[model samples]
Target: MLAVIRYTVPESQSQDFAKQGQTILDTFAGQPGFLRGRLARSVDEPNLWALVTEWEGAGFYRRALSAARLVMYPLMILMVNEPSAYEDVHAQDGT
Candidate 1:
């Protein structure tokens, strides 16, 4: 499962936002089912940032989030929209 959170940061806050994003990613990296995660900035929209993470499954992702609520709740306030979770429906080889 993939979890994605997007944020619209002001130029003045971009550095601070990136640092916060790195903390979130690092926290997730230490969890049981975290597969991979990244922080990205949109080329055309510099203030647009995203946190993308892959988990073993949706259940693991949900559980991890619940367990980390104390740390995540504050971070959630920075998001421009609700975070989303996606299930992969197909693969490059058509699996």
Candidate 2:
């Protein structure tokens, strides 16, 4: 499963945004079923960012968020309101 949280950050706050994203990723790392995660900025729109996380499943992802709400609220509250959870129907690896 995948969880993608998008955010629109001003140019002035990009650095802080990246730092906060890293912190969130770090927090997720300690949770069960956290496969991996990344912090990315859109190439076409520099101010557009995403915190993408891969989890074992939607249940695991939801549990992680619910457990970390206290530590995550500050930045989590800034994410754009949209459907962020997804299931992988098909996946291919370059290798």
Q: Report the lDDT tens digits of candidate 2 across residue range 1-95.
A: 99998998889988888887888889899999999999999999998899899999999999899877776677765678899999999999996
Question: Tens-digit lDDT track for model 1 on 1-95?
Answer: 88998988889988888888888888888888999999999999998899899999998888877776776676676687775799998746454
At residue 78, give the lDDT of candidate 2: 66
State residue 91's C-alpha deviation in candidate 2, in Å.
0.6
Strongest candidate by lDDT? 2
Worst 10 residues of 2 by lDDT: 69-78
lDDT of 1: 0.84
Candidate topping TM-score: 2
Model 2 TM: 0.92
